[model samples]
Target: MFTGLIENLGVIDSFESDRFTLSVLNTSTTSILSTASVGDSIAVDGVCLTVESFTDNSFTVTVSPETLQRTTLSEKIKTTNYVNLESSLCVGSKLGGHFVTGHVDGIGSLVNYISTNKAWEMTFAAPSSKIQEWSNFIEPYLITKGSIAVNGISLTIAECDVSGNWFKVSVIPHTYAYTNLHYLRPGDLVNIEGDILGKYVEKFLSSTLKSTKDRQSNINSDFLAEQGYQ
Candidate 1:
């Protein structure tokens, strides 16, 4: 699991079919490489990818067909791109951000970005035509005032509309300057992972509760049979 806390900004060095070569830039270079290794999982722009190879300055990983279909990685690679990279969390480390599974639900287009003295308020539009397919990742994860991981950076869901396929997030200047979020354009695609906790809660409430209810009903039926009631 990841914390949606970006540790390094890695550039796309090269791409060959489904495989991508990345080079870590900036001062975190050594620290970022230290914890990383072949076969280790890393979140690249909120998409959990396994390292296939690595060196002091660079690494390579293969993107699965499902990943390509669900995330913005394929879109970002059409040109040179910088991705937010975060290594998997270690035991005892502070949970700086919410639980992020590095699982991209679907892609969204950045519709607008407004800069103010305080922060950057950005709006995104999920495809409206295919509501279910477009919002599948976010629908389960969104809660008012709760956290969501966008491009591997954890941010709270400031607001969402019940019917509209759009939401807004307010980004502080520090996050904008440190992460690749600053390089985002109005039309850029983003890999979004809804909060992990929300997903688990939903699963438990939906499946586990149903199972418990069914078992209780069966028990009640057995009790009635023992009492000679049909």
Candidate 2:
């Protein structure tokens, strides 16, 4: 698990098929590699990746086909070399941000961005070509004022439509300057992970409703006997 608080920015050094190497740019106060070790899980652009090997400034991880299909890593590597990095949460570490699983649901693209006096308001939505995928995996969980992890940066939904077609986040100056969000342009792809708590609640509610409806529809003497009702 992660807190969606970006620790460092990394530059994609090389990507050969599945092997990926990232050079950590320790621009932040904390360094991801300082306490990292082989097999450690790191959130790379909101995708949980394992450290296969490491050095003082760089580390390698293998990207599986599923990760590639579900995230923007492949497109990000081609369009930009920068990515947000965050190490997995330690037991006693302060929970600075919302709970982030580092499991990207699907890819979204920057719809637009505007600079406000105090923050940068950025809007994101499903790419036109992949709206179905976004609807299935992402849209259901988006709620106004809810927490979301975009490219592994914890942010709250400043605004969103009831349909969940798009959402906007207000990024403060510190986050804009520190993370890879500064490099994004309109239509740039980003990895998106909805709040884990919301997903669990949705699952529980769905299952409960389904079971209730099934029991109601199957109401009969035989069903009562099976359920051990006298």
Candidate 3:
């Protein structure tokens, strides 16, 4: 699990087939490499990748086929050289952001971005080519004002359409300058993870409703009246 708070930025040193090597950009501060060890999990662009090997400044991970299909990691290798990185949450660490599983649901793209006086309002939408995947995995959980992890950066939905086709987030200057969001452009792909709580609630409610519909109740109004004095 993670808090979706980005710790450092990493440059993609090399990506070939399933193996990826990323060099930490800022090692002076608390970085993923500082405590990284083989078999440790790290959030790379919101995807939880296991550390297969590491050095003082760089680490390597192998991407599974499922992760590649669900996230933008493969696309990122071609389009962007930098990736947002965050270490897994420790037991006693402060929960600065929302609970992020680092399990990306699907990929979204930057629709547009505008600079406001205080923040940068960035709009994102599901790519037309991957509309089905977006609808199935991402669209259902896009609640206005709800938490979401975009490229591993935790953010709230500033606004969203009723149909859930698109959503926007207000990024403060600090986050914009510190993370990889500053490098994004229109049509750039990003990994997206919806609030895990919302997904759990949906699953529970759906299952409960389904079970209620399938079960035959023994007590109707007639039966209740017969059993009770009232």
Highest TM-score: give the candidate number. 2
- Error in Å for residue 146 of model 1: 0.9
Clashes of 3: 0
lDDT of 1: 0.82
Q: RMSD in angstroms, candidate 3? A: 2.9
Compared with the true structure, the alpha-carbon lDDT of candidate 2 equals: 0.92
**Tens digits of per-residue lDDT for model 3 on 1-230?**
99988999987888898999889998237777888889999999999999999998899999999998888887767754689999999999999999999889998999999999999999999998889988999999999999999999999999999999999999999899988999999998889999999999999999999999999988788897998847
Ranking by TM-score: 2, 3, 1
Candidate 2 C-alpha RMSD relative to the actual structure? 3.9
Q: Candidate 3, 191: how far from true, in Å?
A: 0.5
Expressed as tens digits, the lDDT of each residue in 1-230 for candidate 1 is: 98887888988888898899998887363457777778899899999989989988788999999998888888778877789988998889889888888888777778889999999998877744435766666666666688888898999878777754778888999888878889888877787777777888888899987888777445587789999999
Please rank every candidate by lDDT, starting with the best. 2, 3, 1
For model 2, residues 128-226, the per-residue Cα lDDT tens digits are: 988998899899999988999999999999899989999999999999999999999998898999999999999999999999877766678899999
lDDT of 1 at 190: 84
Q: Which run of 10 residues does model 3 get worst, by summed lDDT?
A: 26-35
Instruction: State in Å the error of residue 30, model 1.
Output: 5.2
What overall lDDT goes with each candidate model?
0.82, 0.92, 0.91
Better of 1 and 3 by TM-score: 3
- Per-candidate TM-scores read 0.86, 0.93, 0.92
